[model samples]
Target: MTVTGHVKTAPETTAQVLSAEQRHADELAFLAAYDDGARPPGWALTPRAVVTFIRGSDGEPLTLPAERRTGTLPATMTVAAKFVGERSLVERCVVTLAGERGLLLVGEPGTAKSMLSELLAAAVCGTSALTVQGTAGTTEDAFRYGWNYALLLAQGPTPQALVDSPVLTAMRSGRVVRIEEVTRCLPEVQDALVSLLSDRRMNVPELAGTEEGLIRAVPGFTVIATANLRDRGVSEMSSALKRRFNFETIHPIADADTETDLVRRQATAAVERAGAAYTVDDAVLDALVTVFRDLRSGRSDEGWDVERPGTVMSTAEAVQVAVSLGLSAAYLADGDALDLMPGHLLGVVHKDDQNDRARLLGYWDGPVRRRAEDGSAMWRRLWDLRESLR
Candidate 1:
C-alpha cells in the first residue's frame, strides 16, 4: 500500500492548492515512520502523531532515516503547527475520532471548523476529498446514495446504476467523510444520518436481497461535520441526530498577536499564489488585527466599550483584508497599505446589513477615536480614514 494516496507530480507553475493529505504527505510519512505507537484500525497515524501533525511539534528535531529525507524533509524535520487553537480541544477531537464516534465541530463563522475537519480527515484516513457540502438543498441522497438516471433506466436497480455519495464511499473505503454546514440542511434531511451512524449500515431498497443491498461501514469510517452557530435557526438538527456524534465547539482565536500572525502568513501565501509581491507592513497588520479584535469583542484592549457589527469579524476575514492590502501595495503603489485597510474593513462590515455600518461608526467613535487620542500613529492614520466609512 502506498503511504501517501496516489502520489502524482505536478509542474511547479501550475500547482494550485493541494488537499491537506497531498500538501503534507511527507510530514505524514515522517510521523508515521517515527511513531512506534499503535494506531486505531485503518488509521494512518497514531492518535498522538495525528495531534502532532495538527498542533505541530515542539521545534524538536525528528530523527529520520535516509529514505525519509527528501525535498523539504531533512534529517531533522520540525512539524509546523497548523491549527492555532487550544491543544486540548484538538486532543479531544482526535480521541473522539479514535473511538470511531462522529465528530461535529460547531462555532461561529470563520472559526476554522471546516479547516480542522479537513485536517483531521486527511490525517486519519489519508484522504479528505470524500465530502458533502450541506446546504438547504442537501437531500437524503447526499448522505446515502443516489442513482445514475440513464443507467438506472437501462439496467434497473443494478449496482452499475448506483451512484455512491461521499458518505457511502467513505463507508466502503473506511475513510473519513466531511459534511460542511450540517445545520444548513433541512431538519428532516439532516436526520438521514441518525440511522447510518447508529446502525453503521445503509440499506438500498432498490437492490434488496442482493449482495450490494446492505452496505456496512468498514473500520475507521466516520463522519466529521461542521455547523456555523450563526445559522442555528436556519435548520435545527434533531435530538436523535445530535446524539450520534461528539460535539466540539471551536472558538475564534483569542490572542490578537496569534491572529495577526495567521492573517499575515495566509495573506502572504495568497499573494504569492497570485504572483504578486507581499508588501503589507507588520505595523499595519498589527493595527488591523487590533481593530478587528476590538470591534469583534465589543471592547478595546483597554476595556473600552464598543458596539460590534452583526457581521462576523473573523480571522479568515482578516486574512482577506490583509491580502487586499498586499495587492493594493503591489499594484496600486500609490499609498500606504494601512490607508486601504479602513475601506476594506468597511466593505466587510457593510456586507448584507445596512445597520452594521451604524455599528461600525459607533466602534470608530468609541475605540478608534480613543486609540488615536492616545497618540498611536497607526490609529491616528486609521482615524483619519474614518470618513471613508461614511
Candidate 2:
C-alpha cells in the first residue's frame, strides 16, 4: 500500500515515540500491573511494568478506551527490534532496575546498547532526557553535583545554586539515570560511580549546614550505562567499578531473517523521512538480506564457504543500504522502483574497504552463482558479471 507523502516535522523527541494506541496500552499496563518490576518512589508502573512498557506485552491485549494524558506523565514506550539477540540479557537489565545496582551493557558497536538504555530510561522514568554521556572529559560533577558559579557566589550554599546532575536528581527522585559510553571515561573518572552505588546518596559538602546535604536515592533509583567493547584502546573501566554494576552483554542478532525484517522496517522509516516512497521488491529485498547475512556471519545459507567482510555488517548499515536503494529508484529511475533485483546491491557490498569487495565476489561465486544456476534470472546476470566493478 502506497502511503501519501507527509513532510516530517523536526521531532522534539525521537521519531519512534509512541502514539495514541500505545498511550492506552501504557495505562492498561499500570492498571493490570502484572509485575512490572518494583516501583520507584514516584513511579506508577512497577519496574516490571516498565519492562513490559519497553519490551512489548506478551500478556492479554488491553481493550481500554483511549484518553489523552494531559500532564507530564511518562510517555508510553516499547523496545525496538534492534536488540533481538536474547531475552535473558534483557531480563537481567530489567531486574537491575529493581535493585539500586547500575546496569552496565557492554557490547560491540551497533549492538543496540544505547537505544535499549534510552528505552529503559523512558519506561522507568517519565523521560529519557536524564542522561550524561561519559567521555574522557566527563567530570565528577557530572556524576554528582555542579554548583552554579554565579548563583553560588550570590546566594551562598542555597538550593538555587545547588545544581543537580541527573545522577543526583535520580538519587533524590528515584528515576533511572543513564550514563552512555561508560568505558569512554577515564578509569578514575568512572570511579565517581563507586560512592553513588555504595551509599545510594550524594553528600553535598559545600552545602553542609542545611537542607542541601546528602541527596539519598529514592526507591527506584538505578543507573543504566552502555559501553562499547570496540572502545578498548581508549578508557577501560576498573574492576571495582565493574563489580558495582550488573553486567549484561548484548550479543549481535543471530537470525538472518530477523535482521532482514529489521532492515526493512528501519529503511521504511528513513525513506518516509525524506518524503520518498519505499517500494522495494521482495526478491531484491531477499537478495540484499542474503548478501548481508552471508557476508556478516562468514557462511553461506547452504553452509558453503563464504569469506567474511572486514567491515562490520551491522543492522544499522543494512538499513542504510536499503534506504539508499529506495532513494536511487524513487528519484532517478522508472516504474515501481521496487523491480530492481540485484544490480543496486553490488555497490553497497563493495564499499567500506577493498577486502569487502573480495569477500563479496567470493559470495557471488558461491551463493549468487549457485542460486542463478538454480534458475533466478536477476541473480544469474549478477553472478555472470560480478567482476564488472573491480
Candidate 3:
C-alpha cells in the first residue's frame, strides 16, 4: 500500500486470506506445546509455522488439506508474494527469530528490506503495526518512553503519565517490533539500544519512587530493524550491540524472468488503482524491465558492455516508473500507451544524480541508440526522443 493510491498487493483468495492470524491460532498452540521456549499466547503458529509462513512453501512438500485439518498447515499453502531470490536470506531471518534473537535486515535500497521486514513481522506476530520510523530527530525516548504532556502537567510525572514507545510496547507484550531506517538516527540516539537489547528491559527512572521503573520483555519478544545501505552518515552499530542480533543481507533479484514477473504483476495492479484502464501491453512492460535490468547491471541482453549509472537502481523506483507511465497514458494519451518510451524514462534516469544523466546518455550511445541506429523501428523512435532528455 505505497502512497495510498490504487496500488494493491496480490489479491489472495478468501482461503488464502488469514482474516486474522486467528485461523492459525490453534495450530500455533499445538506447535507451542512442544516448543522449546515458552509460547506467546494468541500467536498464529509456533515459531515453526511463522518460519514456514515467510520462507513460503514454494518447493516444500505437504500433506493434503482435508486429511491434515487439525494442527496442520495447508498443503496448497503458498503466499503469492514477490520477494525475489535468496531463499537462504529469507531462511536466515526466520531462523534468527526462532532463536529469539533480534534480526537486522540490511540491503540496498529497493531490495525489499522494508517489505521483507513487514512480511516477517506479519508472519511471526500476525501484525505489522508495531513499527518505529527512525530519523536523525528520533530520540532515545522513541526507543523507551515519553511523558504524556497533558497528564505530566496535571499529575506531576507519575507512572500513569508514561507513554510507551512502540519498542517498549512490543517488549512488554512479546511481539515483533520494527525500527525502520535504523541508520537515520544519530549515533548517540542509536546507542540507546545498548541497554534495551542487553538487559531486555527498559527502566523509567522518572517514576522510580512509584514502582513504574522497569518493563520486561516477555517470551516470544523480538525486534526487527531495517537499514538501507545507501544512506550516508548511518550510525555504525557497536560490536557489542551487533552481537545481540543476527544480520541478514538481502540481495537484488538475480533472475530476469522473475524480475519481469515482478514488474508486470506489481505494475498492472498499480495501474488499475489509478482510476484509469490499464492499456500498457506486455511488450512495453518487458521493454521497461529490460532497460532497468540492463541499466542496473551494466550489461545488455546480448552480453554487450554498458556502463551503469552511479546510482541505486532499485526496483521500487522501477515500479514507480511503470505506474507513472500508466497514469500518463490513462489520463492523457488515448490508445497508444506504449508511446511513452524514452520520454517517460527520462523523468526517472535524470533523478539519479548528475553522473547518472551522463551514464544514461552513455547507455543511449550504445545498445539503446544503436538499436535506433540499426533497422529496429522501436529503437529508432526512442532515439528520436533522446533530445527531450537533455
Candidate 4:
C-alpha cells in the first residue's frame, strides 16, 4: 500500500529549518535512555522525559540514574530548552498526549503553538512529519486516505491501491499526527476527524469486503492540532468537533526579559543561517521587542495608553525585525541597526489596517518621545528617526 505523508528528502546543508526529530536526534536518544519510567503504549519516551526534552534540564546535566544505564548512552548530558513557556502547560500537554486524547492548542499567530506540537510529537513518537496542513482548499481526502490512481485503474480497489493519509498512517503506526490551522479547513472537512478521533478507527468503504478495510488505532495514537485566534470565524468548528479535543491556550511570553532573550537567540540563529554575523545591538533588540509588546498589549510598559495597531505585533515578528536589522548591518552597510527600526515597524504596522500607520506614529509620539525625554539614548535615536514613519 502507498502512503501519502511527508516525503523523505536527503539532508541538505542549506535546509532553513530541520524537523524537531532531525535537529534533536541526539537529545531524543539520550532522553530515551536517561529515563526508565513507564511510557504509554507505543511512546518513545516517558511523559516526564518528553517534558524535559522540550523544557530542557534547566542547564543542569542529567546523569542517568545508576540502574537505568546502558553502555550505549552517555552517562551525563544537557538538554537545551526548546520551547519558551510555562512548564506546567507543557506538563498538561504531556498528560493529554499520554492519555491519547486530541490536543488543540489555540493561540494568536506565532505564539509557538506549532513548535510546541512538533516538539511533543517528536519526543513522543520520534517523528513530527505526519502532518496535515489545514487550508481553505483542504479536502476530506487529505485527512482520510486517497488512492494510487494508476494502481487503482490497473487493479481495482485492492489493498495495494490504497494511499494512506498522514492521519491514517499515524493510526496504523500509533503515532501523533499534527493538523495545523485546523479551523482553516472547511467545516465538513473538519468533521471528517470527529469519527476518527472518537472511534479511534477508520473504515475503508471501497474495500469493505476485505479485512484491510477496517483500520483500528493501536495505543499511542493521538492528534495535536493548532488554530489561530485570528481565524476563529473563518470556519467555525462544530461543537461536536470541539468536544473531542482538550483545548489549551498558548500565550505570548509574559516577561519582557525572557521575550527579548528569545528574540535575540532566534534572530542570531536566523542571521547565522544566511552566513551573516548578527551585529544588532542588544539595545536595538530590546527596543524592537518593546515596540512589539506595546502594540500587542495595547499599553506601554510604563502604564501609558498607546494606540494599538490592528496587526499582531508578535514575538515572532520581533525576531524577524531583529533579523532584518542584523542582515542589513552585516551585508548592506556600516550603520547602526537602530537606524532601520522605524521602517520595519512601519512595515509591520501596515499589515492589516491603513489607520495603523497613525497608531504607530501615536506610539512614537507617546512612549518613544517620553523615553527620549527620560534620557535613554536608544529611545532618543529612535525618536529622531520618527520622520521615517511618514
Clashing pairs in 1: none
- Candidate 1's displacement at residue 348, Å, is 0.7
Which candidate has the highest TM-score of all?
A: 4
Which candidate leads in lDDT? 4
Task: Estimate every model's Cα lDDT from 0 to 1.
Answer: 0.88, 0.70, 0.72, 0.91
Candidate 3 local lDDT, 187-278, one digit each (tens): 78777887787788887887775556768888778889988887676778777768877888887788877877787777777776554555
- Candidate 4, residue 349: Cα displacement in angstroms equals 1.1
Clash count per candidate: 0, 8, 1, 0
The digit string of per-residue lDDT tens for model 1 on 1-390 reads: 112222222235645888899889988988887786899989999999999999999787778777656676556679999999999999999999998899999999999998899999999989999999988888999998999999988879999999999999999988889999999999989988999888999999999999999999999988999999874456888989999999999998988888989999999888867666687889999988987898788888898988888889989998999999987777667599988887899888998788998898888888888889999888888888888889
Candidate 3 accuracy as lDDT: 0.72
lDDT of 2 by residue, 1-390 (tens): 233343233334455545322434445444333443446565655756655555555544533324533343333433233346565666678777766678988877777888788766766666667889988788888898888899888877787888889888888887888899978877887888998887787788887867767677878788999988754446877888888998888877788777778778878877766667677776667777777777777887788878876666666766777887787766665543333434445566665667776766677778888989999886776676675645
The candidate, 1 or 3, that scores higher on lDDT is 1
Candidate 3 has its poorest 10 consecutive residues by lDDT at: 1-10
TM-score result, candidate 2: 0.79
Report the candidate with higher lDDT, 3 versus 4: 4
In terms of lDDT, model 1 sits at: 0.88
* Global lDDT of model 4: 0.91
Question: Candidate 3: deviation at residue 342, Å?
Answer: 2.0
User: What residue runs in model 3 are displaced by over 4 Å at the alpha carbon?
Assistant: 1-43, 59-78, 373-375
Summarize candidate 4's per-residue lDDT along 1-390 as a digit string, tens digits: 221222122233857789999999989999998887899999999999999999999999999887877777778999999999999999999999999999999999889999999999999999999999999999999999999999999999989999999999999999999999999999999999999999999999999979988999988999999999974455899999999999999999999999999999999888877666677888888889988998899898899998878788888889989989987887676478898989988988898688999999999999999999999998999999999999
